[model samples]
Target: MASRPGAWRNILRRQPSSPRKTSTISHISLPLEIPVEEETLPYYEPEHYYPVHIGEVYESRYQITGKLGYGAYSTSWLCRDLQVLKVSTSLPKFPTATDREPKIYGHIAKINSTHPGQALIREFYDSFDLQGTDGRHRCLVMQPMHMSLLEMMGLNPRPFDLPLLKMTVTRLLIALDFLHAEAGVIHADLKTDNQKSTAPPPKQIDESRIIYKSRKFGRPDKAKGYGLPSLCDLGESRIGATQESNPFVQPHIYRAPEVMLDMPWGSAADIRNLAGLIWDLFEGEHLFGAVFDARGGHDPFKHFALIVALIGEPPSEFVKRSETTGQCFDTNGNWVAHEDEVIPTVSLDNLEKRLFGQEKQLFIQFMRSMLKWMPEERKTAGQLLEDPWLQ
Candidate 1:
């Protein structure tokens, strides 16, 4: 029988009169009848969501208190046990990264380490499958986290102060070192969104669908101390020292030059990615610009031109190593572009306006150490921890 046109939108229940309070749930002062979460997306369907309701319990435990947030493939809810429940969309027979995510956590768990960064990596507490209308949905129980660094950055237009910047960079480097040297994993997608500060939640409702505002994650006063910064989202992570033949990795703007030229990339790619992120956090703007084409898509050639302008051309040996270097450069390892293609005129020194004298020079040196044309030339996460600038 055909399901009703919007049967899946049916709300199982309205708001829970009394939510269990293992943690606090601050309510946002938004409209009572806001739009349904995850309803407007083109790919969204009724069966894709696991049909959660406030006060509903799963696995004979873990009662849902409020909706946390929704992503492309999953919706997170704050639970009664100081846990966030991430229920993934139903999957096909074939396995995907979401399927492997729990196992990746297991791998990290197996590594016995006293590294301070170990605690900085988010880990799933438990995982189980829920039988949904279409297929089984994988649910991960995770510690409640505060706000993403990206969201945090949006709260303040000004760049992060030097103390905050130092703390952020040091913690990230330590976490990366732990993951690379101890866990032997590659966080291929290290960005502001993937790094979150640990914390604490609060939330609306209807019959056809539950209407609620996304809980606000406000920045706490710096006087209270910025919470421990932790890295999350291991679904895209890879478990190897050196990853080869992976054509696609990292966000477009943060993508390393080696990955752009179709060369082998390893943990060093993360160093480069972090360099870009650090720039974004400290400079209050992205370091690289004009990477998007007319259609608003990532233009690799334009990206290369920007890189060339800022960091100078890729070394000849580095150019020869790439499988598809011919697309932008000639056989002689010299850049070849159309008559209209314009290389940027600004250098790093010119673009960086926040610092002066020795401080600026040291900062640029720190960035260059990670943003090298050759992957081998980039410093490891541990080595970067010892950098005088960071100190």
Candidate 2:
């Protein structure tokens, strides 16, 4: 049969049959027509990424099958584990913060928990050091996963169904509870990219670059047995209980008030982060979109102005904790960034769509619990699990 117009070009590669003999048994696919640029190919360098070849066996068990995805730090490959007869993800290594991730995962592993959310967190299966052209690359083995929530949101144009939203929130809260109470950890970054739903086999491989088409998961129906959303990528996670200083963490738009004002932040920051994520996912808009200055740089004062518009001004005591609070708020706790001009006349009550009356009330109340000016004022993950809105 003639090959399809845009189908993958397949080639049989030689694989080692034994210690001495080799066999042309493994098939490798490369895209028939390469695009002007593949996803992370432009950023690929010998020093940064380990050169992965198709049909190559690592640790004498994982056979590189295809490309999965890539971020700024690492590129993931789909591999068939010969010994276990299961598919797994092989992260060659991230150049930055290579040592920190293993330590964080180690801390998470030590906490023995039967909490339902414990299973939802993605942890590395195995790790080893691989010598590459640049240096030793820290390779991580993880379970094969689906595309991320961000990708799913992009693919599906319509609004998220309420049922799916509720279910996702419930699961996320459970996971957060486990991390906070059981693990004494905080997933400081809780964006959609870290949360994944589901992967396809690889399409092609160059000598150094692997080319694969990314797949999009269709919008899930109100079906039972939807796999729990796994929270992956702990590179930015912090030891929650040990954070003594007010460190700048979290994505720009999702920054909690305390984090923005330079106050000591903890797990409550994650709660605020989750509220912002919920707004983005359900409302189809960012609660606090990135505000830029004249030079096209992030103007946090302008960003905080939007935050003030939605949830009233930061409490006086909250402002007192920060030396940098004067930049955004006055001594009287009023927004110093010209609230009349910069702050928009918006509220969560008015901005929220899809729900009405009591449902909206409950949701706004749910949001308020997390979006407080004071960190301690925010509800804990366990407390949020019992929220009527989620129920």
Candidate 3:
């Protein structure tokens, strides 16, 4: 493939394997020649999204059939494990040419327990390195999942019914519990994009009119009902405490307040992301959608302004304790409150009514427990499993 002059190579490098990752796109079939720059993807382009065309074979085994999605660090492909009993699974495993994701998959693949949530966490199969134009790239093999919860919500176009919502939340909570308590891992980014179930096989298409992103028989249809939604994209998954000390850990909307404040955070940050994810599931919109700066670029302060509008100010104690609070909040905890003219800074109580449109006491309580301003005060995944709302 020839490159346009001055085209920036993606950020896919030899990253440390264990990290968090999210932001899902549908199993979209684009013309192999379609310009990525022309299409506005959901997340940062060039950084995460990469080009994978039809009939490209990698590691002399797995064949690239389709693109599931990618994030700030990696692009995922649907592949056929030619070496194994042909299995069709999605491997968002190629975001970084490093050992981190493979390491996390290797860790998860060793579990011998049986639990509903276990099914939700995609099983790791294998990995390999591929020769790319830039350099050797690390690719991971995960049990193929169907569509992301984002896609599923789009398919239904409504909040999940109480039963399905409970089931999904319960399973994901259990999975988080396992990752936090048992495996000693932290899925720094937990959102609908990471929560995926098996998707149906690729549909037939005319090669001339449409781009085909799959093999003729890559693998059989992943089973339904018996399937469980699992987390994918370990590019951001980490073990124990976050080895990196940075403000950015997750997508802006799912980002924790502590993260916004440049304060240290832990696994509870994932819980905060989950709180936003659940709300997005029901409302079909981000609790804190993109906030643009004066230059029309992504703005972090605007996001916090919305957070304060909704959840009210962080505890005064928390503000005084934070290292970066001054950047965002005044002594009284106002962060450019009156400067921005537009965008809803709705309260949590209003958000509950707008999202649920009915009695939302249980759901409200459940979100409050996780979305607390103080990361330490938020419930653990295990403790969340016992939430009366979930019950």
Return the top candidate by TM-score: 1
lDDT (10s digit) by residue, model 1, range 1-391: 0112232122122332222324333444335544345665556776667667667777667898777777657788888887888878876644354676666677777666788778888756777777666776777778788888888887887889888898999999998999888988888888876422222212133342343335657778878754777888777788888777565788887899888777778899999999999999999888875699888878887888888888888878887887588777776667787553678798889989989989899999999999998888999999999999988
User: How far out, in Å, is residue 171 in model 3?
Assistant: 0.9
Model 1 accuracy (lDDT, Cα): 0.75
RMSD after CA superposition, every candidate:
8.5, 8.9, 9.9
Clashing pairs in 1: 25-202, 26-202
Reference-based lDDT, each prediction: 0.75, 0.68, 0.60
Assess the local accuracy of residue 360 in candidate 2 as a C-alpha lDDT between 0 and 100.
91
Residues 167-265 of candidate 2 have per-residue lDDT tens digits of 888888988899899888888888886423233444444544444444345656657434567777776788766465554678777877777666667
TM-score of every model versus the real structure: 0.84, 0.79, 0.72
Tens-digit lDDT string for candidate 3 (1-391): 0111111122124342321213233455545444342133444423122234444554455665455554434456676652221112223454333566656655655555554455556655655444433444565556566567776666564777777777778888888887777677788877776422233333223332222232222223545342456666665788776544667678777888777667777899999998888887766677777566667666776877777777677877788867677767677765644564343647777756443533477778888898888878999988988888777
Sequence-dependent TM-score of model 1: 0.84
| Candidate 2 collision pairs | 29-204, 30-204, 146-198, 147-198
Clashes of 1: 2
Of candidate 2, the 10-residue stretch with the lowest lDDT total is 1-10
